[model samples]
Target chain A: MLKVLKYSFYDLSRSRWTYAYLLFFLLLTFGLLNFSHDLSKTIISLMNVVLILTPLIGTLFGALYYYNSKEFIDLLLALPLPRRSIFLGKYLGLSLSLSASFVIGILAPMLLFGILSTGLVLNLVILMSTGVLLTFIFTAIAFLVSIRFEHPIRGFGAAIFIWLFLAVIYDGILLLILIWFEHYPLDHFALLMTLFNPVDLSRVLIMLQLDISALMGYTGAVFRKFLGTSLGMSIAYATLLTWIIVPVFAFLWLARRKDF
Target chain B: MIVRDLYKSYRKHQVLKGVSLGLDPGRITAVLGPNGSGKTTLIKCMLGMVIGQQGEISANGKNIGHDYLYRKDIGYLPQIARFPENLKVRELVSMVKDLRNQPANYEELVSRFGLGPFMQKPLRNLSGGTRQKVNILLAFMFDSRYYILDEPTAGLDPLSLQRFKEMLLNEKQKGKAVLMTTHMVHLAEEMADEVVFLLEGKVYFHGGVQELKDTYDGMNLEAAIANILSLQEHA
Candidate 1:
């Protein structure tokens, strides 16, 4: 698996898209910092972009990489390596590269603005970790969709739709549900719905960490009441970790039975 | 290597039905059939690329269903030479060697195919024929005991084709088993010591080149195969 991972990382290291992704984050971070010297405000602004953009790029890049590497995967399948190794290696290689870009793209600008000397370093850390987690979760889901659907267009379309549903539509539907159940105590329902979507879960987690739950209205105050404790925070992180684990195992199972 | 009573299907369409054959060392067996006749399916089943719904494939007397290490002895050349874009030929070759963790001497094969100039070129930059040459080189680079090539000569020029044929013959002389599928019947006529004719998921004929010809009134290999297909269509 490590051997395959090394080669995969090497293969993707030259990808122009990865560099483009990194450069986009750099420019965004630098631009945001230039506009606001207030460190907390910049972190919150960066959080919004990371929540939407990381998952989007992860989905698109993951699907594109899988389709493009179909031939390479066939070649690897014929070799002595196990199917688990080839697939998981590719997934990790992609996720790690994207995570590296996200980290560097954010960190370079944060360091330049003298973030280390301030109290907001931990906030930036939380923001970057959320970005990395989103990368892994969305990439794994994209890989699963691509593996299940053989045609490139269908797989790419399905992946993009998933990102759309999770990042945008899921919130809209949640809003409708909240309005429909306006008379009842609905904090638990709202929390459960947030847990179902990694994107929303990440947003709540970041907003809570930034100490801006008051700005989130009633749902924010409810989120702070439930997720303010250390125990609740641990559970949220565990849920995010589960999001990464489930899709990875599902793809590995599919890869084993699939015919090249 | 032996494949016994193999059966495979995609959805409701059965591709291979109860096909059986054995590969002997130091001989070349050409798997021939019309389009969609399970030639590639059978090859994939044996290599465990496509799992058979019902069958047993054994390498050196061990069942290969749950074992991947058995593939270490077989070198496979797929139908098309698909490679990662932006990867140089030299890097691809080295990557395979690194993955296999075995001593491989690809220098001689590269020189024989005259791919020295394209060593530093990215795989996508090479023409189809050059890519095919690279595919052939990768399949023959390691000294494996068995070679399974699917359409091994698809896009080669005459000179590279000749070199490829010579290299295959050299491997056969070294007591390696070579199983290949090809549409070029004349090339099969020249190189195959035996032939396995698959017609509609079954082996219609499995015998020597001359025996197949003699059975069909001494016609050439291509016409003999065509005759089998025509007879099947009539029946």
Candidate 2:
């Protein structure tokens, strides 16, 4: 398993795109955090970027990577290698890479801020963990999209459109609904929606810790009430872990059953 | 190696219709046919690359698809192979070795295929024939029990062809099953222990090359193939 992962990492490390993404996002994260004095404001500034763009870029890049490497995969498939190990190797390598980038881009700046103000260190750790989940959730979605679509462009377009709908359009429409139904507290409805989208849940949880989550709506309150408890936070992380493993496993099954 | 009544279709169009054949270990069995006559599909089915709708394909006493625990003992050279542009010869060999979970003697493969001087050069710089040679080396690397090659010598010089034939003979000597599909009937005539002539989606004739010549009013395989096609039309 370690060898497989090591090989996967070696393969990706050779790719110029991987290094470029890491460096580009690291610079971008630093720029965003330095946008303001108050960490919450700096965070909201970056949130606009992270919530909308991180998953979109991650999904598109990951999907494109898969599509472009079909010949390599065929060579591998012709060998005695098991399909499950291949999937795990790729998932672990990609997840580890994106998490490392997230740490550099988002977590590092926040961690430095948390150090100056000691109480928020745990809050910052929770927030970064949420980013890890968010990255994996999107990576899985992208993997499925890449396999399902015959054309790489089609897969990339579908991923971008999904990101647009989920991150931008869905939130916009939901806010409109919330404002109109001010008398009716849709706390449960928001929780269900957040659970469905790890990205949304991540955003809400981070904002709740910063106590500047008014725009995050009922979802923010639910995460604060539930995930504020240490056990609830652990359960939330566990659920995110499931989101990572399930789709990848499904992809393995699909690839195994597929007539290559 | 045995192939039991195999059936396959692509959506509404049937490609292989209840085809069955056997290949003896230590001998090359050439599958000869026109395009879209299920020659490629049959090979693909045996590799479990294409799903057979009915029946089973067994090599070394195990079914091809689900019971292919024996793939560790199989080598496949696909019709067309593409390599990464920037990868050197060593990188290419390394990639396959990692996938196979076996250590390959790079010197043996490189020297055998005349890839030593070209080792440092990227795959993009190599000729099409060199690329085909790379694919062949990868296929013959571990020397498993079964070899299924499609258009095995499409791009090769006389020397390379001789080397390839020698490799095929070596596999046969080791009692490894060799099934090949090729347009070069001359090579087929030279090497085939038995000839399976297919037309449309079914086998029109299955016998030795000499049998094909003697039974039909033809001198060699091309005429024999023409005779089979005409017979299929008459039938």
lDDT of 1 by residue, B1-235 (tens): 9999999999999999999998999999999888899999898888888989998999999999857898889889989788876789999999999888778999999899999999999898999999998998888899899999999999888988888888899999999999999889998899999988888899988999999999989899889888877888898
lDDT for B102 in candidate 1 is: 74
**TM-score of every model versus the real structure:** 0.97, 0.91
Candidate 2 residue lDDT tens string, A96-206 = 777677767666666666645656565556556666667777788788777777788898888777777777787787778877986897877766666666666677667
Q: Is the docking of candidate 2 incorrect, acceptable, medium or high quality?
A: medium
Candidates' chain A TM-scores: 0.98, 0.84
Best by lDDT: 1
For candidate 1, give the lDDT of residue A104. Answer: 97
Model 1 regions lying over 4 Å from their true place: none
| lDDT per residue (tens digit) for residues B1-235 in model 2 | 7888899988799989888998777878999998889998888787776788898888767666654356687788988877766788778777777667765655676777797888788888989899888888888887587888989898898898898898788779999888899988899999999988777788878888889888865678887777667777798
| Candidate 2, residue B129: lDDT | 91
| Stretch of 10 with least lDDT, candidate 1 chain A | A6-15
